[model samples]
Target: MTKFRFYFPDNKDFVDPNFDGRSNNRTKYHRQYDDDHYPHQILAELPYDGMLVSLAGVGTMQKRGKYYDQELTEDFYFSGARKFLRLDSSEYERIRLMGDCGAFDYHNEYEPPFTVDELIEFYDRGGFDYGISLDHIVFPYFKDEEAKDVAAEKCDLHELIAESERRIDITLKNAKEFYVKSQNYQFEAYGVAHGYDKNSFIRSVKELQEIGYRRITIGGMIKSKTDELLELLECLNRIRESDTQFHLLGICRFENIPAYINAGVTSADSTSPLMQGLKAGKYYSVNPNSIRFSESLMIRVRQYDHDNVQKHIDKYRDELRQYISELQDNNGFDIDLSSAALSVNECVKRLEIDCLKKLQQYDETGLDLDVTLKALIAYERVTNENYLPSKSTESKQTQLKRNEDKYHQFLLAREWRQCTCGICKGGLMNIIFRSNQSNRRRGIHNLAIVTKHKNNVLKSINPAAK
Candidate 1:
């Protein structure tokens, strides 16, 4: 049995909630901020082994005055990957560092801007245990039958084939040089493979083996459908050499894990599980993991995403709360300030705060589900936040009712308390609260689940390793 490796791509995702969900200068890039806890540091303190970090930071883009800057925000010019991530200490021995060229960053280009020597220099500076050679992207089969978007309009068969073959030639040529020159470098090297079709893909892999490259990564398959990818893997498995290893780039389908392993994947990495938790309405829930596991389901919680309108709501709620406190000083805590002299906006702001208090209270005691959610529905209608519900001319009453139904299902189950991970140990409310800090914590929790299942599956395959 081949010992499969599971690598997680680090994105510096988790943040300090106190800094409005932003990392400060102290703990922004480094890992040694022990005093404040930085929410106790999940990727470092947790059992997040087999970590993969990119040289240019994958999907790195920032907007300037008129145009966007493709440069990664981290000043890696002075510090290496480990130092920048604050993983230089011996405590993070579990994290097996892998450096990636982030070829997807320049996928649209005719050729990679950075050379093989430049990547090798980056790998040496990163102090990585494993590194992938640079390769240009080869798009999956795209013709008149497939594309739904404007890519269909610009589909030129002659230009597409010509461009794809150009990428393949350069990638293979560069891989040969990279693997041969990699003898001087410290990190173990893997040549990247790119091709448009299955026959072309197999031919590229064969050339890689002839170049004395034992490890080969199949690139440009991110857009390929599951069945198409499996067919390619099946073909590759027939010609797979015992000594050589294979890895799939940017594709991890947790729904069909056994199929991929059976098709022969020694290692793979993906950010989907953790990122799903980060996105609104994309909540991932899993069955209890034993030696044998079941399928995981992503429950789409239908509710208004208040992140964008939260600042405005917060401002109104704060002002109203202060005024109410002053009113309470004159009358009493039990006094009916509901009938006090106030505008419609002030009344709505007060309602929003009241609804929020009930929601928080429900999180603690798990009581008042109906009344609290009803109050929330009323407040949601009053505020009319920037979500689709507000934009559409649909029945507000019907939308609010659907929101209540979803919240009822979500809250009644209490999925947050299911984990024994370090993040879940804090409090249930913190994990499920409608805030970025909560969303990130929830995502990291899902990653823990994913990590466990991957290890267990591999353990089942190779029992003697442990």
Candidate 2:
């Protein structure tokens, strides 16, 4: 099952109830401060599969003491964040840290120096799991590469891989040693970021794999590279064939999971606690069913003349809550007595909302080619996962053909070609790209045609040449 993790800021200060959900430095208040029990109270209330807290000290360290600079603002927090951070202190939650390893590089750069033993002591004091966010690793600093790279050398593939290895080795060593004692610590390494090259990205993953790091994410801040993303999918598929756990990271959108899931990705991490958090009606959060209704709503709303976006946002939020309420009833939760209904219906609804938001954002912001491909994968996955309601209007044959055509279109777009023969020398010659059964086609052997000269070469010539 895919897991959703809400990032809880670890700040201990009491937040004003009317603080307005905005961060002073660069952080945007996603969840209001609930100063009493940390974010655990919120985490325990929700029916999420996993919990992901950004490594401690990130907010204070990354943009600490910096004034509201628009460029730096956009670099860390997305647009509209400055306003969002001004939330009441009462609405904010204090995040608890279980382990001592700074989970992010940005914080590490500014974090006060602490020995490994101190980190162990923190965990021994009762920590759950510790992980490093790869946001700072794969993404260029401050979301700007050229500026950050002026001082640092462009990440050479070989050199970066070597450096990453030492880091992973240390992490793995710590995790192993820590787990042995505590028996409750989980280890994770984050790598999904947008815009990294195929070679460097894969090399980093390979290094992580060598050091026993699992749970790879695909995109971060909607900036994953298309070629590298597909290659990552391929790598994940191969890993799945060999029986390994794979995870897609920062997957707030619904349409991004199917490729990874079909390729055997075991889980996904997202933060979409409420529909209104990531822009009210837009289902950019992890809700599947919510997005379906939201998409329909957006289409209907677009038909009318609406001036302000807030009206649309409010409308979507209302509709989403209604569906969620209906799902609670369906789940047999006590609608009359129970204050909140958390069930699979709400989960699906939330995912739908996320999908709708993602699609709309892509359309509005000029979709990335890699994201476009990921969206297609999500489409395929949703259909495959039985999330999209089945239609009785279409005959089975029609449905089969449509599905076949979808795969063909994807393959064509990706320029995927199989070998013509065992030797793999010739291009796909007379290839049978599709078959009548379940979209499986015989490649290589099925497509090969023996010419006279090729036959002679196969019989007598060197096997390598053949």
Candidate 3:
């Protein structure tokens, strides 16, 4: 039986809530951060044993020179015993450039791309358990002739192919060079296999094997659909050797994991759960049987509508006044009527009213209005600020017909409340009610749930392992 591992990609923006330069310095943020923060030290604290961080990400961070610009020297990125696979910077840059040229939208900028030697130095200094040879691969979107033609005017296909071949040669040469340079390093270097078609993929794998790579990573499949990926997996399966282990780069779909594993994939990586959690409507929960469930939160009345803003404010104000009067009548607390008309249309008013209601519900005394207001303001600023709900013009019947399945799933998950994950432990309402940290926490919880499911499956298959 084969041992399968899931690798989490290090995307600082998604995981770290306090990633800004003020709270935490950008230079050492990746390598070090406060462990007490829920999502900041996720990589270190999470059960995941493997990580897949890009050289381009580190290079970009290095180029910015946030904290350790002058101190980077030549090997700052890889100075610790972190178990990660160092991906080549070229493919990352190509994706950035392609996005710049209108291939697709990519978030990060491509800056100060690292050379092969720099990568090697980074690897040597950073005590990684495993490293992958750098290979430049083409994006799957370029397979379409029309798309290729459009991209060719700006990014030439011929040039990309040549560059890819050159990178492969460099990767192979560097793998051997590094092996000879640091024979006692104890780090395993795997070759990267990249190609567009079946024959090309076979040739790439065969060449990597010939160059003394017992382990290979299959690239150029990130954008591929499930069917397309399966076809590629089938092609690889046909030529796979018994002793060689293949890692599927960026293949993180839970439903497709079993298929990939059955097709001979030993390991894979993805940030889907984390990404999903950041998006609107999507929420993740774990089922009783350990299967992960995804359901969209029901869209409620839009709070941002120009017409309803005043209406909501008026209603909340009425509710607040009524509650306060009830409290006064029952001699529950002292009434401060001076702050009653404190700009009802303002967000601060809503936050204060909400917090006060919560306090009243809990029957708490010594209400520090200032502290509660400040805390609520901070949370609202991150979670609810600038949030605009989309106004759909479709009929209610039509909308229900379209979202029948989604509604069914939402109802099922809402009723059961069996999901015991950290995020869902607070109850489905915490995640269903959209808030910045809650959404991200839900994603992290989903990742944990899916990881457990994967481990369980692997354990069942390989029951002999302790």
Which prediction has the highest lDDT against the true structure? 1
State the displacement of the C-alpha of residue 239, model 1, in Å, after optimal TM-score superposition: 2.0
Best by TM-score: 1
What's each prediction's TM-score? 0.77, 0.35, 0.62
Give candidate 1's whole-model lDDT. Answer: 0.64
Q: Write the per-residue lDDT of candidate 3 for residues 102-128, one digit (tens) a residue.
A: 101121323224444555554556655
Clashes per model (N, Cα, C within 3 A)? 1, 47, 1
lDDT of 2 by residue, 261-280 (tens): 45656554443322222122
What does the lDDT read for residue 424 in candidate 3?
47
Off by over 4 Å in 3: 13-32, 35-47, 60-112, 141-184, 287-392, 395-419, 426-433, 463-466
- Candidates ranked by TM-score: 1, 3, 2
Looking at candidate 3, the ten consecutive residues that score lowest on lDDT are 95-104
lDDT of 1 by residue, 128-212 (tens): 8888987888975532234424454767656787788998999998888899889998899998888777777888989998988
Evaluate residue 123 in candidate 1 and report its C-alpha lDDT on the 0 to 100 scale: 79
TM-score (C-alpha) between model 2 and the true structure: 0.35
| Candidate 1, pairs of clashing residues | 31-86
Name model 1 segments beyond 4 Å from true.
17-40, 43-47, 58-79, 89-91, 142-154, 289-340, 383-403, 460-466
